[model samples]
Target: MTRIPELLAPAGDAAALDAAIRSGADAVYLGASLFSARSQAANFAAPQLGQAIDKAHLHGLSVYLALNTLIAQDEMETALQIAGRAAERGVDAIILQDAGLAAELHRYLPDLPLHASTQMTVTDRAGLNMAARLGFSRVILARELTIKEIEGVTAEAKRHHLETEVFVHGALCMSVSGQCLLSSLNGGRSGNRGACAQPCRLPWTLDAAQKDPFPWLSPCDQSLLDGIPDLTRIGVRSLKIEGRMRSADYVGQVVAVYREALDRLQDNNPLNRQERDRARERLLLAFNRGGRFSDRPISGQMGRAFLAGSYSGSYGLFLGTVLKSDPVTGVLTIRSDKASNRTVTRGDVLSVRMSGEDKERASAPVGKISQTSDGWRVQGFHPDVLRTITPGLQVYQMGSQ
Candidate 1:
């Protein structure tokens, strides 16, 4: 059987951790309360982290604690303590951004696997090999890499016997990894250690006249959903998702879409148009920067501009639920269940809601009926509609009925 790429999802908190594992992620990456860069994210406290490790292991998924932020002279002791604690919790790995920190952890916890975080800006074969020599079992390649670049890097990693991971889907950085100073310059928050204020997402201007009228910045979120097949061919071991602040609902939906996408591709079957369309629509609804309606290329003109909107310190989607869905009469039902009604529509997109609280959760689409009968029965359904039906007789729906 062909080996599938490990799907590494983000777990911003205990709930998010459950959501990631429940959504069928092979592993989850998260951070501790301190020494990690995602300060705003609901990081796990030391006790909660040990609990999280136990829970993830019960589900047979690995847990990688994020030690991937910069370490100041005063923070080195705290960082090492966090690493030692993670090792004690039996964490599968610790992702680190600082080479000195990684080396520090390596000497103290030789048994623990170390991953060089993307903050290392591994742009070439030599850089990756160097990381491998430094005791990094896996090196997350920079997001800016092109397909050709990835191929070369992956080959190099193999020659050096190091595992290579990549960001298959997530927010695109405006500057090169470890090279971005925009956030610190603009908001006084450094991006190197993951405290990025995301200045790139904010609108900018160059000329005085156009400063107010024409916003100068916009960056598109990256989606390698379509590129998973090629990435798999290049021997990438893990695919990472971005959004540490996003909701579990969003995590579940995105993970499910990628899970399904990779599965279909692994079978050597092209993503039938329906599958591709469905994945695109789900991502847009989850949260996206402007693009060709979210289904277009991951990066380019408008998409790029949209992603670079502005940094608000905190930016991401909220938790939502499928209030209902009844397929008997051809109408889908939904409710944001949150304060914001971002947008919901028919034919837009729908993903099975996976919850950290309910690992076995599944969803069936509610389609609109073209023809109605004397009662609740509807007619004129497509043959493929069978795929949407679950074994249970009950159909989920929403609306007055």
Candidate 2:
């Protein structure tokens, strides 16, 4: 049987790398400590880089280090140093944005394969050919291309002896891949090299720009959950999931969904329509850019902690415990009897684990709260998950039914 297209996931840090690998990513893409475009990520330092590579390789998954940033004259030496360390660490591939660097690495580290990061804007046959000439074994195509364009590019890539990968799901930039200058221009942050402030997530008044003055220009996050089979059928070599900035729960949920989708499609059949529909619902619930498409949350809304530095562990529904409600304050105080993965919140939707006759999961919204000397009491949306909680065992949210 032909091998299924690889499922690629992003790792902003070491923990996230472990999360992706455990959650079923065939490979994980990350950055070297210094030169990665995502300067904000607590990227793998030089010493830690070897450990990450070993872990991924131990699991039989590939590690691709991102050297995918434009290097100014001053940054060249440092960038090459990072590349050399990654190569010595036994990384499977190096992703680069610059052709010069690609050629340089190819000459110096002849054994290492090069992948053209999307920052190179490899969206068309011409670009693909250019990458091949520069010795890129694979080209991570731009995210904005439609399926037809992808098919065309894939065909051309194959003809040119190059492999093709496309972003199947993730947050999308407002501008074309590798083409956005908004961050560097507006905030002195260079988005091309990964210090994006994510200006797109902010609600902007177009009239303020004196250009197009409508909310209509706001681009929605691109979701190809429903489009996976079409992509697989086109012979794409890999499916990329974007979220170096997302949590483990988000990683697990998305990867599990896509993993199931890919499994169903390997029979040369289209993905089960129902699975895609279900996956879409799950993706929305898992936290995304929400809009007519999915809405990616903006800064200042969800603690914005991610904007400052990377936090690897799960949050929100990750942890919680059974608690008595403070009827007056609407807060659920944890009961000594039960603990949670993280903390229980008012709007949190959770599923209860159950035996026969129940769907095995139920969700509730925190409504009323009354704190007591013994513990906390709280109201719920449905109360099914909360009601089923046993006394001594802490009832936390179940991942999926």
Candidate 3:
């Protein structure tokens, strides 16, 4: 009779919301247009949000609206109004970053549960106690905590009758949550106000040369797919994924894997090696934006663990190396380790990068494929690429199929 922790997924819009639920999410957190951490995401307008809450409720999934952005002096009314409307729509909970907003919401809508957002940067016992005292029933721990730190925080929260939630998977920022000002400094878009321009994803440079050619500042995405059992055993009430800005396909794939993993753990039958490998493939196809991941943040592997070449965004899965190419013949030879020509699809986009430096690259959609003596010969390389593509370049499939 072990308690299976809730599987929470991100829902940036109506499409992502549907995908999350269909893929077996226990609960979903989403942006409410104005006050979302990911302002760039396709957040829900007020009306759309109401509809979204109803839709998720229909599937028996708890919908937690993200009003986690810091409210401005003149915008307090709008912030309170948004929380009140969400409560009226029967939202299961509201995630809060600003203590003032949480207090107002709790005072006005006492029945609605408030989950303190990771944006609050909570880690220690004192912070958790402060959140509980401020009327928060649950607290989403900061992602930077080590595994040991998390166990301690969870134990303390339990003592105060407060539920603990943590980010088991997804992207990590260079700065701690709610502490980053790089985006606001580089561009006028403030990360705290929900208008982060994601400056961390871009290449940084010194006066004369590029400082970190790769995304050295951007931490690798987290993947605690193997640690589900330990988290639930330690009394972690919810496992949250952090990708409201990602695609529905991405949300669905991650949700399915984590859901399956949680169920298997609950039944005391973890996925076998082959099954785990297959799940990893599904995740790879869905989105592998960053390179390597750690089980916990304090490992200090964030800077060194990034993917090889394409560090800025989704580089998809690396297929294989290009053996040969001919601009005149309009054909390129590719070698895949998977030994499956079935992966070829017309119009499938691919990034061709020099094996040495992933920066020198060009992407093209696959037009046609034929079996060859050595491997599969892909024709119709992107017109811009046919001439420039060189042999021995690594080709990565971008995005999901």
Candidate 4:
């Protein structure tokens, strides 16, 4: 009998926590107010952490606390204190990156399960062995591994009795998980310390003649929805979605889609083509880079196509190209493609993007939308916002509400 992999979701705040529970996450990973990799997120305080854990437990969900940042010598005691509090609150596990901290937690709180964070850069059998020696109960494999590599590692992990976790969806860093220093080198913020400024998402240029600033360091968001069957077959313990800085809506929608997929897999009813297409569309509507979801196979090598050089941030659902624009009237005539079958209605939030532009364009709610024989005529954006629009540009649905 194949064991279904656990569907893990991310919760950055109370709303996201509720969203995860309502959307049906088997488990949730969240951070405290301090010492989290996503320090910028509205992390929970000690009281809030206790409440969140209680709420999740009521829903039959496990909560894992993230203490996965590099702890300085002086911060070691405080970090241990945080871990102790979480353990007392009945956190299912604690994820860690610092080996020294892991040793301390093992010695002091011997019963608390420790998960080796991907930030620990564990990839091979040797790393798995090291994690076991350090008293870790689980090891999150690095994101750079191909499916074959993951299979090999999972087999070896069983020998050490260490469960394995893999990232199934969300952002992928250009550099390896734990080794990135570009943020600290270029800016004062250190990714290891959980304060990345995301300088890689910014546009850069190699040639002065180039007109467009390209996000060469940014990779497309990972969507392994299609790979769930394979992962389950290989006995992966958990499938994690990576977004703590994203909105509650994003967390809910993405979790719902993955939840359905996992249920289908467990029931042995794999998604057919049309079902897969609809799932892909729902995911795109929730959030996406301006690229195909799951651009590369889980087993294939990541190449140039994996890079999201064209756009770095979420553009939502791609509507169509602008055939004509009237900046003064704030109307756009668009040739609908991917969103042709979907209905466009009033109050829908829409965004426009021009080729070679790196920054997000001004978005506005639609006051009017009418389908034409050839395309759609959308109206009611602020003229000031429309002034940036032009023909031959792309449009996207940022939100329906």
Q: For candidate 1, write residues 1-401 as lDDT tens digits.
A: 45679999999987788788877899999989986767789989989999999999999999999888788878888899988988988999999888888888888888889999888889797797679777999999876677778888889888888888988776656577545887888899887766787666565567677644322344556677777878888899999988778778778878888888777766777587767866776675566653222212323233343442332221223324433335554443333433432343233233332332211233333244322221123222333453353332222221111
Q: What TM-scores do the predictions have?
A: 0.75, 0.74, 0.90, 0.92
* lDDT of each candidate versus the true structure: 0.68, 0.68, 0.80, 0.86
Candidate 4 residue-wise lDDT at 260 = 90
Instruction: Arrange candidates, best TM-score first.
Output: 4, 3, 1, 2
Candidate 3, poorest ten consecutive residues by summed lDDT: 300-309
Deviation from native of the Cα of residue 240 in model 2, angstroms: 0.2
Q: Which stretches of candidate 1 lie over 4 Å from their true place?
A: 211-215, 291-401
Model 4 — TM-score against the truth?
0.92
lDDT of 4 by residue, 1-401 (tens): 34689999999999999999999999999999888999999999999999999999999999999999989999999999999999998999999999999999999999999999998888898899799999999999987788888899999999999999999888878788746899998888999888998878888887999887778887778898888888888889999999999889999999999999888877878788789888888888777776555535465865777776666567677678888878766678888875447767888788888766755566778889898977789897777776677777877777666
Q: What would you estimate as the lDDT of candidate 4?
A: 0.86
Task: Report the number of clashing residue pairs per model.
Answer: 21, 31, 1, 0
Superposed Cα deviation of residue 260, candidate 3 (Å) = 1.4
lDDT of 2 by residue, 272-358 (tens): 666566566666556543112332221112223212111111211223344443334433444533332133345554433332211
